[model samples]
Target: MENKRKELLFSREDIQNRVKELGKQIAKDYEGKKILAVSLLKGSFIFAADLVREIDAPVRIEFMTTSSYGHGEETSGHVKVVHDLNMDLKDYDVLVIDDIADTGLTMEFVLEHLKAKNPASIKCCVLLDKPSRRKTELEADYVGFTIPDKFIVGYGLNYGDYYRNVPYVFAFVD
Candidate 1:
């Protein structure tokens, strides 16, 4: 990340408020049911943790690590499931959470994989949605922020794995 400059995209307060809203809406949508919160790891960990707490419903958390970018900035046009879910998806309402939906390939792949397990229903929730760069016909059910086609880091997103600790989202400006 050397020589790269960052500009604020979302502040900590902004993320908190939006996450709470998403949580409430999701809770209402899945009323009277417990949901299996499937968080796509490495990037969505922080967001997922905060989101689940705000949601006023019963949520059992799970983490799956999928990769398409191997030490690079762009997607490799393919996805690999580094780690699979431990819980069975059958008869469960699953919420797939991710930090960002950039090319859509990863989320689509993940959805298809989980769908095979016969989950009652599956929906996607992403903290950031970059539809401009989407290479697949998919959209997240809940999006905290719809960002432009900019390389971003922070708020669990990272550049060269360095900015994940930042509490806000920022875009490369230099």
Candidate 2:
């Protein structure tokens, strides 16, 4: 499994530091506002957990599982909501947190769906952004890192659910 990785892209320490910075920024931006941190699951859970702890302001957390990729490297261009949030998004400042914005299809689907729920505002925060692979014009409101088009795994991202526990993010060698 170790041999599959080409090289490390972001170390655990590096990611933690960046997450802290993002948390601080989010706290400031949403000061005195009701924040609901909606985590797109199976990938961004780890990031969301860390981020919310860093935020000084009170924040509610929710999880939803939406996928364009079903245990594969590339998306099929079809999004599915495997799990939905339990709470109504009305009046909450919704911050959608995701692992990566690759083709933008998943994010677009999520944002549009949440918009119908009549949230006060909606914004996206992504751990990684690969604009080169974007099929839509959408962009993340807050991006932890803008990476080149690479098949990345680890740090809650995975290859067939195998490498999510890895502490660092890396690309596959072969």
For each candidate, what is the lDDT?
0.92, 0.91
Q: Pick the candidate with the highest TM-score.
A: 1
TM-score of each: 0.97, 0.96
Off by over 4 Å in 1: none
Clashing pairs in 2: none
lDDT of candidate 1 over 1-174, digit per residue (tens): 567677899999999999999999999999987699998989999999999999998899999999888778899998999999977778689999999999999999999999999999999999999999999999899999999999888989877767888999998786
lDDT of 2 by residue, 67-134 (tens): 78998899999999999987788879999999999999999999999999999999999999999999
Model 1 error, position 158 (Å): 1.1
lDDT of 2 at 45: 87
Candidate 2 ranges with C-alpha deviation above 4 Å: none
What is candidate 2's CA lDDT for residue 25?
A: 94
The alpha-carbon lDDT assigned to residue 25 of candidate 1 equals 97
Q: What is candidate 2's local distance difference test score?
A: 0.91
What is the model-wide C-alpha lDDT for candidate 1?
0.92
